[model samples]
Target: MAAQGQAAAGSASESGGSPAASAAAAAAAAFPATSLYVGDLHESVQDAQLFDVFSQVGGVVSVRVCRDINSRKSLGYAYVNYNNTSDAARALELLNFTPINGKPIRIMYSNRDPSSRKSGAGNIFIKNLDKSIDNKALYDTFCAFGNILSCKIATDPSGESRGYGFVQFEMDESAQSAIDKLNGMLINDKKVYVGPFVRKQDRENVSNNIKFSNVYVKNLSDTVTDDELKEMFGKYGTITSAVVMRDSDGNSRCFGFVNFENADAAAQAVQELNGKIFNDKELYVGRAQKKSEREMELKEKFEKNIQEVAEKFQNTNLYLKNLDDNIDDEKLREIFAEYGNITSCKVMRDSYGVSRGSGFVSFKSAEDANRALTEMNGKMVGSKPLYVALAQRKDDRKAKLQVNIFLHGSWIYTTCAFMLFHNSECLVFACMVGEKSGEFY
Candidate 1:
């Protein structure tokens, strides 16, 4: 936003600067075909006020005040177009810091070539590096990237590396090159991350070692030995070293590692073996990421997917079918009062939220959910048969999921069985996977 300014031509009180002529001139230029960009106006400020303020500096092209599309609220920033560079320059000089209704306006030269701006800061965050990796190592790793000006490694009180660091390549282009080649690259079994230098430790763990490079093999024929493993892989490259991890029994740990003389061979080996059938066991191979990284990724994905599914049916609402037609929320409450606290329940209706045909009952705990699903899953109540799995209203089923279904029933079997056993003592012996003991009818 830096600019060079020239002095204004004459005083405003000059006879030629009569208020009538100036306002008319400003109004006339307000609708020029092109070249206006006005910015930094108050939300309540109208387009006319902006035109009046900017037109005084130079001829206006078009004035547009931005507003939210849905809410119709002012976005606080607006654009004004001028017919040419001269007027824009004059406006920038004249209005850059002038306050309008107590709010300062920031005027700048509109970028004619906006594409020149960077899309994103390239990846350069250090990741998966050993906590032992010091600032020196971080500098060493990225210096070759380019003429690094300033590199920073975040450390703790002891000065031990916090497993991540940052390197500024002294220039933006060099930083970009490092991003292109090194992002998602493995460093000590981790990937180097790159981005604008922000102080967030959480971003460092993002897929640091996701580029697969190791293999998981099980059901290894007892005959397969470490040496045999090496011999098999030796054809690929000058072997780095192959070690068969062994159990306490000292048997071939059933898995081994083969470092290649070159990365290409290792890459090919990984590609060929990932999910390829070998020696009867499906050979799994890919970039070998660390265990904690894999766990974190899986955990996140599990939680996300579970939440999506749970949202399909509102996990919050519970439905109770087969209720006694005469039974209402109060009557049902008395029957199940001993279970636990109830959030809220009403027999659903068409428009009144009344009971449609069968009503819903909710319990606060999984124990309650289990008790409801189990006690009501197949129980014949009154004249209707009660059925309960989870009751999601039709409208709710189509909405975004708010509840987490995966975490909802950690021990579904036990919760369910509790309900069945509580119903009767006949020991009719009905078996379900989650229940330890069968229910007796």
Candidate 2:
């Protein structure tokens, strides 16, 4: 909401000299036919005050200040019915800023049915209100800026204020003026938040658009509670809710969700807390992804992993045995560089920091590797002959291992029954096909 200055001419009737005449002049420009909406009255200023004030202009018919059904307290606004249309018009002109019990009230033409009014025409939403501040208190607090049409404080089933309300002014300028002066102002030691009133559906759509503000956290300590989680993430911004998941036994499931007031706070919490240790275990925090999204991402990663492994076997990679214990990755690359553009080279190392006496060298092309294998096979390196051959894939290595196991009688079986009895585990079932038929390759 924004503020606007009231025109000086509008307040000329408040100066007192022949107020009724000045009101009649102002009414010519903006006047109602019969009823006037009076707002900003103190909780004690009842229908009597409204009737007494408007009666000064002309004949008065009825005055009703809306109130709670159970408590029967003033809702801070009322409707005044005047006998003559011109009398109602003059009431708005002169009584626009008339004081009632030390508070200046706003008066405007009555548009009683909200359904007939334009949506959000001059409305503002107010929240963080003190629980004790009823409709009258809210109205009296905001009435001085401009004429108000209707003011309402949301209440619960028990007729208690829900700490929020709505204020609608006759003119947008007046609504803006009130917001500018009263928004964030302290009332009853609590600062209230004021903003433009949006329709519920529009608010829901906006919330959906920024739903990333809610974060999912896992690996929480068993002792962690909702309040603790809120305190941890509240530094970033206001938190809407925080909950730690639990089991049937009331034990922590090691997971939780934290919803912030805005996306920026959620993003910050994710960046700073993801993978950070919490209660002796690393916690995972991130935007809560749907189950379908997680499954799709895992599938893509699996496909990518298979592609990478396949790429290793397709390149000009060569396996070498009898690699010197002292040969490191850089030395192996240097030795193979003369054999036509080596793409990569690495000597396998054991846990004790010694080479496994084997290494792999990948060249830019298969032709280069074939030539290098021909030239380097049986060549002396560190007093031992180098054994050069095409590198075998992980699956191919498994196939060879199965052949060696079958030859050594480790997988001996006379019939399919015996194989099934032993529950034989084969890494490459296809490679064993030829072995069972007396053919070994």
Alpha carbon lDDT of each predicted model: 0.52, 0.67
Per-residue accuracy of model 2 over 1-441 as CA lDDT, tens digit each: 222232332342364544334433444345445877787666577788778878988999999999979857677788898897777766765676667876667666677576746588789999998888866566556555455566778864224577899987666886786666667777677778887888888888885565478788877888999999999889989899999877679888767888988988898888898889877988878787654444444444444444344344443667889987888889888877887987778787779878899988878765577668877989988778999976643433421321122223311221111110001122221212222111112
Tens digits of lDDT, candidate 1, 53-161: 8888777877878887985666767778876655764565456546786555654334354332223233256666666565544544554444433345665422345
Q: Which prediction has the highest lDDT against the true structure? A: 2
Using all chains and alpha carbons, the TM-scores for the candidates as numbered come to: 0.35, 0.33
| RMSD after CA superposition, every candidate | 19.5, 34.0
Model 1 residue 90 CA deviation in Å: 4.4
Highest TM-score model number: 1
lDDT of 1 at 415: 14
**Model 1: residues with Cα > 4 Å off, grouped in runs:** 1-46, 66-78, 93-108, 112-114, 118-232, 250-256, 279-282, 289-441
In candidate 2, the residue pairs with backbone N, CA or C atoms under 3 Å apart (3 or more residues apart, or in different chains) clash, namely: none
Can you tell me which runs of candidate 2 are displaced by over 4 Å? Answer: 1-31, 36-81, 89-108, 112-118, 211-441
